[model samples]
Target: MRAKRTPVLDRACRACGFSDSRGLTHAKLQSGETVTLCGTHELMLRRAGGAVDAGELRGVLSDRRDTVRRSVGGGDELAESLQEAFAPNRRRTERRAS
Candidate 1:
């Protein structure tokens, strides 16, 4: 029995290492190999005579737009929390002079 191939959900872009899911897309090359790509690389592929699905490209672009919109709307709070989480340890370790 042939093993079923599972779709990769967390693949990094082939041309660039942009792993953000919001702007990532998959394309099947004429050589029958599937590749993950960021929006820029996908457009490059299309411009270089590669076939890209119009519907899929539109969906990816719309989703990316929505993500950007949400980020612009309320990303400050999340950014602050992340900053606090990754901030250097501030507790003093030296013994205080009595």
Candidate 2:
């Protein structure tokens, strides 16, 4: 028999632990974990901390979902590997543009 598994939550708020597939913003933490934040929580993360600013960045996997309402495939291992390989170049270009 197949082992029981819990379906992954498409969105989970890292701040308040709220979770839903809708109204969630996907972002990457400074520690590199991908987390979903609601509008309320996203605002909180943008604020300055005690002495430094938050190091989080909104991920590319977000916004398009709500803006266009399209489904995304996360099971493509080869594609994910390729993306990771070029991540450095992508970051450099982004930095230059900014």
Candidate 3:
């Protein structure tokens, strides 16, 4: 009987900040392999035609919004600012879902 094969574990580069959960723009040290990056890094990679999975992008955006909200103490004014900054993107994402 043949044994089941285990999936290879993917790791992120701490120096370059790559991860499987995020999206990748450039090829990794190993040719033909893609590397995932955080939102901040993704934006930087955008110019290079880097793309992220919509769901992952949304999660990152939400986390960033939440971080901003918490940093501002989650007050009405802060929430309003965050909404102003992030609401448009949220709306766009929702519209794309339809």
TM-score leader? 1
Model 3: ten consecutive residues of lowest lDDT: 24-33
TM-scores for all candidates: the values are: 0.43, 0.34, 0.23
After TM-score superposition, what is the CA distance of residue 79 in candidate 2 from its true location, in Å?
59
Clashes (backbone N, CA, C under 3 Å), per candidate, total 0, 0, 0
Each model's lDDT: 0.66, 0.56, 0.47
Q: Which structure among the candidates has the greatest lDDT?
A: 1
Error of 3 at 86 (Å): 26
Give per-residue CA lDDT, model 1, range 1-98, as digits (tens).
99998766447776657999889998776655677888887887776667455444344433343353534454577798887666666324444689
lDDT of 2 by residue, 9-33 (tens): 3456755567775768865455655
Query: Comparing 2 and 3 by TM-score, which wins?
Result: 2
**Over 4 Å off, model 3:** 1-31, 49-98
**Clashing residue pairs in candidate 3 (N, C-alpha, C atoms within 3 angstroms):** none
Position 64, candidate 3: lDDT: 38
Q: Candidate 1 — worst ten consecutive residues by lDDT sum?
A: 57-66
Instruction: For residue 28, give model 1's deviation from the true position in Å.
Output: 0.9
Q: Name the candidate, 2 or 3, with the larger lDDT value.
A: 2
Error of 1 at 66 (Å): 34
